[model samples]
Target: MSLLRRLVELLYGSDRALRRMLQYWAATCVLYVVCIGLVLVQVSRGMTDGETAHRLIVFGSWGALAFYALIRASARLGLKPDQLAVSQAVFSMICTMCAYAISGPLRAAVLVMTVLIIAFCMFAARPRQTLLLSIGSLAGAGGVMYWLQAHDPLRYPPMTELLTFGYLAGALLATALLSGEMSKLRSRLKRQRRELSDALETIRVLATVDELTSLVNRRRMHEVLEAEERRQPDENGTCIALLDIDFFKQVNDQFGHAAGDAVLRSFSIAARASLRANDVLARWGGEEFLLLLPDAAPEDARHVLERMAERVHGMPVPGVQGRRISFSAGLATRRAGEPFADAIHRADNALYQAKEAGRDRIVLA
Candidate 1:
């Protein structure tokens, strides 16, 4: 099955037009083959219809081969596939009209085939196109009836013509209405799916990102930490750092909470510029953030933190009077085969040391 699917994909080239053309080609071939087989069976059963069978074989074979060639040529020329399918339907309706003109009993069969063709078009073609196909088929039936009545009045009686054509008109109308409703339903479903996808994306952002600073939240940071730890055994080093804004509570008290928020936002921007591309930064809690540095030793992690502290010191806080914002950070490199929690504990201890020794400093453990 896989091989067959690959072969089909190769033939169809993965474009919608090519795939749709392939579908039409396959269905046409199957229908023709079945008709030819039935005709053969009738001949074998002693029915003296060799001429009819011969005509069926010749016309069906020729039409199938010609249509297949057209499909291939159109694909090479970049023609629309749906147009090709529509052309096939028109050609089939023409053949049905010819059959109805010649054989009296085949007139009813032709009407039935026309109804099927309209139904197929209703699903496959646009609403306007489906209506056009139905109108054309009905017109063709009327023309064939007129020709039969003029040439061979005995073959098609008035009652037979009226019944067959009237029934076909009703069938075409019903099929057109169904196709229009189905098209409307399909459009509604497509719009709803797009809306659902957008809603899901919004929810994901809200869950994983901090709204104030637009940084990853603590929960996402923990996932990154765990993943980094698993990768560290095969890597050179992994380090974790804790950063706390110095005198953040004082900023909130002196100015206002709104000014404190502005400070946090400004600090987040400066810190991002100080870190490398592989570093991960997330809001840990109020006025506190965590940084994960993959492939960094304790010294390398401390350098990054120092640079970040300098950046924070340079940034102006609107709420604060004259003092620039600063943060103290604690850094710890993970040991071989050690649990991630131990590194975080060491980093926390280092943070306490930085706070004790005086704020706005970095301590490495």
Candidate 2:
């Protein structure tokens, strides 16, 4: 089992081809073992000549040693799948030729091994390689048949040899064509899977992120608030705040909408810089935003918001002159796993109170 695993790693290197290569190697080993055993049984029964008796033992031993050497070399020097596939094809052809030579013309059943080699090539090699291997296999087999017919006409008659060679060549070429079509389909499926994964990731980002301010959008903000409420224990604190830009419409009225956009971007940058790493700022609507401070009491939330307000007031927008950006805020601390909607409602009322009293102030609920 360990030897089989090593062979898979060396040949396919974790590709989808690994499983097919394992099956091929297992089948090849079984073929050799069964054939060698059968031939030895035939020798014991006195069914074959002394010359034919040597063929199976010699060929089986040679194949075992050659494969052991191939495995060792593959480990010492990393051989890619294509390189290993070509090497296997070459080795199989050499063994087939040796089998034909030993069996003689009349008992050349060893030629069927070429069919197995061609079948293995369908999965292991690319389309071009399969075609080339098929052609090479056909040529080798035809050469063997021609040699037998010319040298031993009584054993291998010309008409019978022609029909057998034609069928063998046709089967090999047909297998190559079918394998090429399957390879193309596999490649297309892999490409489609990758493209679909990328598209889904893109959609998720667009849904959560604001296009203009690069902040979390309102819909995602509600989800975050609800999650935070669930996470807070009875003893822990969760602070949330809603803020509105002070007289933002006046800014847009005096300076065009483009300048208003610049102001919003600048405010987002300044507020983000003033807050802690764990704090989350999200766009609630046009000229309105929400901020979340996890594990923070009402006082801690107020201090953070005050610092943010000062920072935002000092920050200057590029297109607006003689004006400083300021925002009115309302903050509420949830009590013992309080619902998010209840806390946000209190914050909204506090925000209205601040707006009525004066702009650019924080009122706690």
Candidate 3:
């Protein structure tokens, strides 16, 4: 059992890691294609040997297909992005070393490109994995260069001794600058995405939340109720409560709308505190509120509302000194197969009864 649990955790962890890694890998693949295309455009224009050109094209196509398949398979296995990025970086380093070994004159360019690629991968991948890949790529490059120099010294003469090392230095410098610019671009893009997400969330909150009571607005309440109904198909057994502040209009006329708003806000806070986390509370309109209690019977809903009313009545508003805010609540349980509107209507009628019988009490219908 312990071994099985460990295996499950390992699999889940790897999946999460791969998902994070895959995002970076996707970006890296785009950059890789761009670089390869540039090289191909430059080299292919002068090539007359159909056989050599065909071989080059075939290798490039195969490389792209292989990378795509590997990435797709990883995604299918539910790998997380981070793990995918690290794995791809390692694979890229391996391929870079292989390419350097197979090609002679292209070794300098490949070496510089591999270094830059590895550096970018390191910026995105875990520290340990990045270190391992960097070391492996460097060792592989050195080994291949050594072997080539030993076999054919003339073909692999030291570039440092020729042309004052200007070309080699220039290539390395350009690679470094390009890698740094790419890193900055990635950072800027990530920041922009985060800011946009935050702005959208803010707009959503403003649309769905009431500014005065801090409760959900009417539209949001309907959306939530519908979602809950779908989740709990037997919601016919659920209870709905519609509450209106008793003498709210009288208070508004006597003390002004500002005081009325304060009373409303205070009552909402108290009522919310009196309910459970799963219970829903919303501002149903001016001086009115609604509560939806899933899996609650009529008796239970009444008890909950009675408690909420008592709490609100006991709450003291700053401007309404020595005066308590009271509300009449109507409680109704849905009958089997009853529509949402009918249940609300029943609750509203019960609320009217509460106001008529005596204010600040729960009436069940």
Q: Which stretches of candidate 2 lie over 4 Å from their true place?
A: 1-77, 89-124, 314-322
lDDT of 2 at 16: 52
User: Candidate 2, residues 206-248: lDDT per residue as tens digits?
Assistant: 8998888989998899888767766764545888899999999
TM-score for each prediction?
0.85, 0.73, 0.64
What is the RMSD, in Å, between candidate 2 and the native fold over all Cα? 5.1
* Greater-lDDT candidate between 2 and 3: 2
Q: What are the lDDT scores of the predictions, listed in order? A: 0.79, 0.79, 0.71
Model 1, residue 28: distance off in Å is: 4.0
| Residue-wise C-alpha lDDT for candidate 1, range 1-365, written one tens digit per residue | 59999987777667776667778678767766765565566567744267765775688678878887787778577766557767788877876675565444544764666766666665457777777887888888888787677776677786778787898889887887887888789789989999999999999999999999999998888888777766765454888888899999989998889999999899999999999999999999999998989888778888888888888888876767797788888888888877777888898898889999998898887
lDDT of 1 at 23: 81
Compared with the true structure, the alpha-carbon lDDT of candidate 1 equals: 0.79
Candidate 1 vs candidate 2, TM-score winner: 1
- Which of the predicted structures, 1 or 3, would earn the higher TM-score when compared with the native? 1
